[model samples]
Target: MTTHTPTTPEQLLEKLTALGIEATTINHPAVYTVEESKAHRGDLPGAHTKNLFLRNKKGKMWLLVCLEDRKIDIKLLGKALEAGKLSFGSAARLMEFLGIEPGSVSPFSAINDREGQVKVVLDTQMMTQSPINAHPLTNTMTTAITPTDLVRFLESIDHAPEELDMNNLAELATKAE
Candidate 1:
């Protein structure tokens, strides 16, 4: 029998330890995008997330987490949040604030927010997931956590997220059609 070794996200282990949350990380080579991450998934069962790091015209930063299949309309989001026009934050902004690269973005990086300059917005539907999956700082690994533990971890980082309805996606889809 070929034994499979378990890999963990080093940064994530440190963060979860600090928050007193237990988690398991599936290790793989770094992936730059969600599409690339699929190659590393081996039998892990849970709802995976698609994390977007964005900023409003006002320079306010946001970490938006949603289901992998969810679609977002930046225009409608701007109108809903009353944030004028929103755009994907620059690579410099993302690295400086979240300490992550483009395809490796994940809510887990919010732990590096020593200045607390970013706001996290989670899709309400994601809250229903018992075991939510995300990249641990890098796309090299995926971490699974209980929703309760995740909330506590977010609170520990002082990053209280605003949960928005997934219906917003449907509205955008309808308008597009």
Candidate 2:
């Protein structure tokens, strides 16, 4: 079996351009959480994202992206997705599948999943917002792209997401909140 070479941040940006996606990226200190990212984003417009790499007991993997501040309950989310008790995928599984580390998880990393092993999930509320901000397969920079372009990029990589209706997900957030 041939190993898939991991796509770098520069390659991700090039792919965005090749697809006619107008995106902006800015360098910043590496941020491991939503709160830490806010200080570094510096007025970057659009919806900021918090990405979760999850796995079920059966080995099903999911890349779930939502608003940075949104509350999430893993059990509720697992029930909603019928994923059977989902938990965070380990760093080793993350690297093997998405070619990214824990702090750098993003839908863009799906580009590296040649076998399409991960199920991508996006929050509907975030989908409605433009210029979505996420890491471009790394934590040291933030890339901004329109929602349409974001979906286009995912589709280009054959990783079209299962859009989660946040109106329904709000109940789960309420439980956590």
Predicted structure with the largest lDDT when compared to the true one: 2
Tell me the TM-score of model 1. 0.85
What TM-score number comes out for model 2? 0.93
Q: What lDDT would each prediction earn against the true structure? A: 0.78, 0.90
TM-score per candidate, in order? Answer: 0.85, 0.93
lDDT, candidate 2, at 58 = 94
lDDT at position 174, candidate 2: 47
